[model samples]
Target: MDSSENYRVVCERVAAAARHAGHEVTLLAVGKTQPASALRQLAALGQRAFGENYVQEALAKQRELAGLGLEWHMIGPLQSNKAREVAARFHWLQSLDRTKLVAALDRHRPADAVPLQVLIQVNIDDEASKSGCRPADIGALAEAVRAAPRLTLRGLMTIPAPHPDPRRREAAFARMRVLFDDLRRAHAGVDTLSMGMSDDFEAAIAHGATLVRLGSALFGPRR
Candidate 1:
């Protein structure tokens, strides 16, 4: 299918999922490894929020699409050396897995720039290879992020380990929802639950994901 057609299908599915959940869910078009033109095509269809994994690649795309007025998000594992650039560029940081990284982002964020929206990525499935804070460490990290003058703690995010059983995926997403609710009760103004992706976003939504990151479904398998 063409880009426009692909985008339409994804949007429809997202909307349906949101309807099923009875909440508004944001579709974060994962643009990692995609070209500026692909972004422009999506942007033309009224897509504003885009997710990227690599800071350098995102920066290049941001520059290329400077005239488009899109909102970029850093959704991959971030490095200490790359914090400043991510702080200066992306509007949202969804992979905030450590307190030290939070401190770096807060310190380097330009005073004139808007406060960066943040989501504490929780290692829900506790995979050793994943880049997210353990579920037990969320409170401390959330507090640290809340104290950061330049960061706005939006909510929690997680990339659950893929499972063959649909019920297992649902269970993980439901667990994330519970954590998200608990976080909201403990912290004021906490709202977003950035979980889900192309494969299991429907399940994520069914269990209460406010944001779903999509790549292949919208952009046709990344190059």
Candidate 2:
């Protein structure tokens, strides 16, 4: 199918999932290795949010699509060196895993811009290679984010270990939902729970994911 057809199918699936889950969910097109033109195409189809893994690539796309009013999310592991660019350019950071990054992002955020929307990525499955904080560390990291003048604590994000069993994945999502609920109770304005991707979004939504990221399912496989 073409991009528009792919978009329609994905939207229909998302709407069906949302209806089943009894809540509204947001879709973030994962534009990682895709071209800026692809993003323009999706934007023309009413996709307003896009997620990118690299700062430079997202910056270029942002420049190319300058006036579209699209929301850019940094959905990959972030380094301290690139915090300034991310703080100044991206609308949201979905991989905040440490206290150090909190300070860097807070310090570099432009005073004129709105507070950067932030999600605490939790390593729910405790994978050694993941880019999120330990589930035990959520509170401290959340406190750091809240104390930062230029960041907003928007709730949790997780990429669970891709277990072969669907039930196992749903279990991880359920755990994340508990963490998200606890976060909302402790922090005012904590509403986003970004924990789904193309393959398992329906499951994620069933467990309370307010935002799901889609790439191949929306734009076909990356070249």
TM-scores of the candidates are: 0.98, 0.98
Give per-residue CA lDDT, model 1, range 25-65, as digits (tens): 99999998899999999999999999999999999999999
Off-target runs (Cα >4 Å) in candidate 2 are none
**Candidate 2 lDDT over residue span 87-181, tens digit each:** 99999999999999998899899999999999999999999998899989999999999999999999999999999899999999999999999
lDDT of candidate 1 at residue 165, scale 0 to 100: 93
What RMSD does each model have against the real structure? 0.7, 0.7
Model 1 ranges with Cα > 4 A deviation? none
Best by lDDT: 2
User: Global lDDT of each model?
Assistant: 0.93, 0.95
Residue 71 in model 1: lDDT = 93
Q: What is the TM-score of candidate 1?
A: 0.98
Give model 1's clash tally. 0
